[model samples]
Target chain A: MSFSKEITIAKSSVPKVALLVLATIFAFGIFEVGFDQGQLFSIVFGEQAYADLYIHELTHDMRHAAGFPCH
Target chain B: MSLFITIILLSGCSAGVIHGLVNLALVEPYLDKAIGIENQHMFASGEAKDTSQFWAEYYSYRAWQKGGQLLAGAILGTAIGALFGIVFGYAKNILPGNSFAKKALALAAIMWITLYLIPFAKYPANPPTVGDPETILLRQMLYVSFIAISGFGALGFYQVFRRLKSKRFVAVLGYAGFIATVFVVMPQNPDAITAPADLVNGFRAVSLVGVSAFWLSVGLIFGVLWQKLQPDRVKQARFQ
Candidate 1:
């Protein structure tokens, strides 16, 4: 007796998980670099984060260079 | 899928780092010059003293920010690259060109013009002292809104182009007209240009160069990586 088998594989579709992950990254990274304003640090440092502006100062140069509005 | 995401991110990070390095060389001087003007203004206004302590803190913060330029470039590149990857994934078949690299480059150029260049024309980059602290939120909203409008508008028009069998140029004209109207209708930056014209102009020029370099690098790198990896290809074989 003889037996025949067939297989097919497709990877054409972009997985939703990957899209979601990339979207999240895109949003977070853009926010961090372009419009952070100490908001990220404020998550941990409370109100004082507003004063420190650690993320803001760190991204200050690029923020201006990349054309994001900055004070 | 993992490979797909990995290559996309890798290309972005690499391009971003390149962008950072380029900015360090081309853009840093203008930043320094602008900040110098800002320092003088602060001294004159008595907002800050030109003392050793002030200098120390200024240098320290400036150093941190200078370093952050590269880091931020990487982050921004990855972020934008992710968007590029997603778009490329969907549009690769339709994009003009024989190779992935060429197609990616084409897409990059399109994006650079729509997302960055047009918005930039409406709200060009300004140096530190150019913007008012009180109006920061409003300015941010304006910049982001313009960018979103341009980007989404391009996407919507692309759909129109795709559906048309001929005279796709109509969609192109439609987009141009739409954007032109928006350019006229949009509010201005609302901030006064107090900085020296030369300094502000120079800064804007370098800023354009830096961003253009990032887009070019991301496109080329992502294209090459995608071509090499063939992440979307999966082969299965069976014999009897």
Candidate 2:
């Protein structure tokens, strides 16, 4: 497929999708950069890995909220 | 400048969608495989080990749900990384030291790696000091971290590079989009859900460090990779 087509097919996001991602990333960023460091349940044992996972999962949840078709 | 940014964002969204599809089709099975290892370890261990130990007692960790989480993470991260890169690029042209998103990703990644990815400890609730649970936890944590750090890094960076051709929100959308794909496609859950014995007292400083560092690295890798992978369209737009 052409680059545009591939990108469109691979990474297209609706307005809702964008909003969800923005929301989740902001939450994730706030948590990771701020509160996660505290002694509560938010531990950064596997920093990038978990942050990466959090971002990933947050996206997943956000996607579901956005009415996107799941894999 | 506004015209240029609009195209880059479009490219980013397209990249996100593509990433989701790819994860659903190609990467779901591997998640299942990772789950298998985690399951096997949990099953074989009879002593009722602490769930909070942080890593595999033998060498695995997982959930009962399908490999949806990993897929979701992959797709979503790819998009975010791309968006961040493009925004940074755009800012560079507009003003001096204006690379906001790019800086955020880099700082976040490095912070994650340093805080969570290091060799660390997890103390057992009631240690006979025989098995040295801390050591085991460290190894397992490392293994799990490997997946996120490399996966996020590569995927995140790739998205950044694609921002020139598509919608800005597309990359942002991809983070959730790919995750949605994984949630629907995966066949099983990977978590055991029991508390680890190590956490009986609390998450020791060493172990927590490992956790933070791992995620930090994950963010960084994905962030940078996305930045580097932008399409020429994005570059042209950013310069415009």
Candidate 3:
């Protein structure tokens, strides 16, 4: 008995859903790591989030290490 | 389709974790040294008190920030990897390499040069004590804008590169000239460097190493995964 394998190449078009997902991840992750000034947590925590700077503090070291503007 | 996304995300996450670990070991020392300088300035200016309470809070938060370094690395890595995957999906065939792994590595290097090194040359990374709080927003805008210009500019010139089969060198020269012009036209980082030269220089050197590791790891991992999985192909069996 002999076995043969057939390979079919798919279209080159990048899936739209995949693109959207990747784009969203790109935006959200960059904002969180590079530019977040407590804006994320502010949704629930309100003004206190800005003062607390939870995301800012959490990402502080990486912020500087990764070359983003950090105070 | 799911497999493609999985490979992209997994490679990104893994590379990012590696980037975080690398930062922890190599970059953390510089961060501590710089933050120490910031603490001394705070004490001198009465922005913070040098007391047991302050020390306690400081240690606690420093621990938290250090832990977050790894988390942030993974996050940033994934974000960058997503962008990489999108590009690879489109440009894999056109890229100059015989294998997926080679192609991935080539693209990674290009991105590292265009998106990172060039922008970094304009606005190099600084330690914590270097920047002024007042000018941070402006600095951020400048940095992001420069990276965007470099990235999009490269993309635009790549089109010219594809169109001109005979003298592709012109595309390279054109991009170089365009970026040089932008570099001159762009505003400089408004904040002055107040930190010690040794600390700032050391921090930037190590930061470059950490980021370089991420790009390398992402390229290798993503390429290997893509090669092994062949997510874009479907295989069927026929028996005779």
User: Which parts of model 1 are misplaced by more than 4 Å?
Assistant: A1-13, B238-240
Write candidate 3's Cα lDDT for A1-71 as tens digits: 76767584635568999999999999999999999998999999999999999999999988888889887
Q: Can you tell me which runs of candidate 2 are displaced by over 4 Å?
A: A1-71, B1-10, B47-240
DockQ of each: 0.50, 0.04, 0.64
The digit string of per-residue lDDT tens for model 1 on B5-72 reads 99989998888888888889988999999999989999999999999999999899889999998899
Interface RMSD of each: 4.0, 15.0, 2.8
Q: RMSD of each candidate?
A: 2.5, 17.8, 2.0
Candidate of highest DockQ: 3
For candidate 1, lDDT tens digit of each residue in A1-71? 44444332223346899999999999999999999877898889989999999888888888998999989
User: What do the candidate models score in CA lDDT, each in turn?
Assistant: 0.90, 0.36, 0.91
Which 10 residues in a row give candidate 3 chain B its minimum summed lDDT?
B231-240
Alpha-carbon runs more than 4 Å astray in model 3: A1-11, B236-240
Instruction: Name the candidate, 2 or 3, with the larger lDDT value.
Output: 3
lDDT of 2 by residue, B34-117 (tens): 334444565578535445564453233233122433344344444444344343343333222233335545544533332223
